[model samples]
Target: MSSGGSTALKLNNILIFGLKLLVSAGSLYIVFSKNDMHQVGVTLTRIGPAAFLTASAMYIVSLLGATFRWKLLLPERFTLRRLFSLYMIGSFFSSFLPGVIGGDAVKAYYLNKDAKKLSLTLASIFMDRYLGYVALIGLGMLAFPFSLGLISGSPYKWAMPAIFGSFVIGSFLFFGLRLGKRFRVVSEFYEYFALLKDRKDVIVKAVLISVFIQIMSFGAVSLLAFAMGEHIPVKMVFLFLPIVSTITTLPISISGIGVRESVFVLLFGLIGVTSEAATALSLAWFFSSFVGSLPGLAFYIRHANKPEVKNS
Candidate 1:
């Protein structure tokens, strides 16, 4: 790329980052303006250090589960310990350094550099993320019927179905149609996809593990609610958390800070939770995950300057 083109791309990224920052700040402003700050503070204070540490530990366990699922999609050459390190580093980059380089890209870059098989490495990373999302959507759909009474009259009632429908259509187009087979790059990617497709056992195990990881994530959030002295039902947490997780994945705000808080207040409000308590719960959940990601910083520093070794 020419210097001018590179400069233009950097400027565009900067602009998008600025917009996301504004969105996060604006959303928080709106959320706090309408709720009682004193109540939110009080609820947050209810969470002791022990609860915070437990929540953080739960998040680490979920990351370990995620590492196992990703391992199922990769070659046996990648050991569990190595994969766990990569996962931690990826999480650190994702949670701590948004807009710099994405966690997935970081994982792919390091693995691809060593494995020297760009297509397969990239495909495995994609599959790891894809299966996790599939589990999240599936869980939300399963819980939708049970929670209909809670969202019956609200506009958000259709969100789960709409999201599921779109996912189904998109999946059909991508996998069924094999739309990009004509392109060399696309065909290379498809080669790895075909290999994974043939391994039914591996796919099933990965999906099951993904479900487990998602549930662990839900449990971590529930722990935070408990810490805040809010007795939100476990069923409601399972039902509503997936939807919030899905929406927060959208890149509308930084690290999902503002978007997550807004959704928590809205959904938890259905069960008579005050806006302040819900907001406190949301912040606590993020902080726990943030603490869990801190180890990735150490991994990054240790490995950042290491020379890459290409496997023959």
Candidate 2:
């Protein structure tokens, strides 16, 4: 690529980052302006240290479960310890450095450096993310019937189903129809899927592990709500959290800052939760996960410059 082209790409990235920052700030302003900031502060204070610690631990367990799921897609030579370290580093980058290289890309780069199979490494990373989403959406679908009373009049009544339908159709086309096989550059990428198509055992195990990971995430947030003296039902958390998680995954806000809080308030309000309580819960959950990601900084500092050992 020419210098001019590279510079244009950099400028484009900067513009996108600026737009996301603006959106986050604007949404946050709206959320705070409409809610009682004093109440939000009080709700946050209700969470004790034990609750925070437990939530943080649950978040870590979810990360570990995700590590195990990712491992199922890769070669056995990669140890859980190594992958967990990489996962934490990825989390740190994702939480601390938005609009930069994404956590998935960071994980792929490090793993590819050691494995020396860029295509397979990238494929595994993609599949790991894909399967995780599949499980999340599946859980949401399962909870949808039970949640209709809560979401009856809300836009999410249709939005959740629409999201699931799109995901199902997209997955079928990509995996069943082999959508990108004709493209030379991506043919190798699709080949990995072809190879794994018959590996039902691996895929099932990965999805099951992903389910466990999502449950742990839900449990973490529920613990936070409980800490605040909110008695949100477990089923409600199961239903609402997946929708919140899916929406926030979109690259619309900075690390899902404003978007997450808005969705939390909207969904939990149906269950009679105040905006203050919902926002506090959302912020507390993010903070716990942020704390969980901190160990990644230490791992990065210690191992980032270390020599990569090629697995035989």
Candidate 3:
């Protein structure tokens, strides 16, 4: 890369990072302005250290589940421990740096540096993320009818539209990609798609692992809610969190900062939960995720000065 090009890329990243922070701060302000600050404070205080630790433990479990899923898609050359280290490094970048410059890119960067089959490594990472998303949407659809029974006349009456909208959009995208294989313009995408398509066993295994990843994720969140003294129904959490996960992934906010809390507040409101509790749950969940990623920083720094050589 030329010096000027490098500088331009750095500047672009900085600008996008700043914009993400601004969006997060602005959304947080709006959410906080409408809520009772006093109650939010009280709710935080009421959450004991024990509950926080419990949530952190669950977060660790979730990370392991994710690592397992990612490993399922990679070559045999990559060991479980090595993949876990790579995942941790990615998580470190993802948590500390939000927006376009995230852990996914970091994971791809390091892995590609050493990858003989760069395309396959990259495709593995993409499929890892894609399967997780598919599982999320599948869970949402599974929970939709049940959610309707639980969400009558609530502030979140509009959730029905959002849920159904996501389903329709996902279906369109799925079929669109399937049909897109015929076009030369998107041949690269189809190349990877075709590679994975022939591996039915790998796809099935990864999809199953993806389902476990979501279960662990929802478990972590449920533990956080439990810590906040709110017993949100497990079924309700399943129904709504997929929608929340999908929105927060949109990159409109920094690490989903304000968007996550706002969604929690809205969804929890349906069951008469206080905004304070909802906000606390969001923060707790964030903290657990942050803590879970801390080990990645050490791993990243340890590898910072290493020479980039392809693994044989």
Tens-digit lDDT string for candidate 2 (148-257): 88768877677668889889899888877878688764688887777887799999999999999988898898899998999998888888887898888889888788
Summarize candidate 1's per-residue lDDT along 187-282 as a digit string, tens digits.
887888888889999999999998998888888888878878789877778778877987888888887778899999998898889999999999
lDDT of each: 0.86, 0.88, 0.78
TM agreement with the true structure for every prediction: 0.94, 0.96, 0.86
For candidate 3, what is the lDDT?
Answer: 0.78
Error of 3 at 2 (Å): 9.4
- The residue pairs in collision within model 3 are none
TM-score of 3: 0.86
| Candidate achieving higher lDDT, 1 or 3 | 1
Best by TM-score: 2
What's the best-to-worst order under TM-score? 2, 1, 3
Question: What TM-score does candidate 2 get on C-alpha atoms?
Answer: 0.96
Clash count for each candidate, listed in order shown: 0, 0, 0
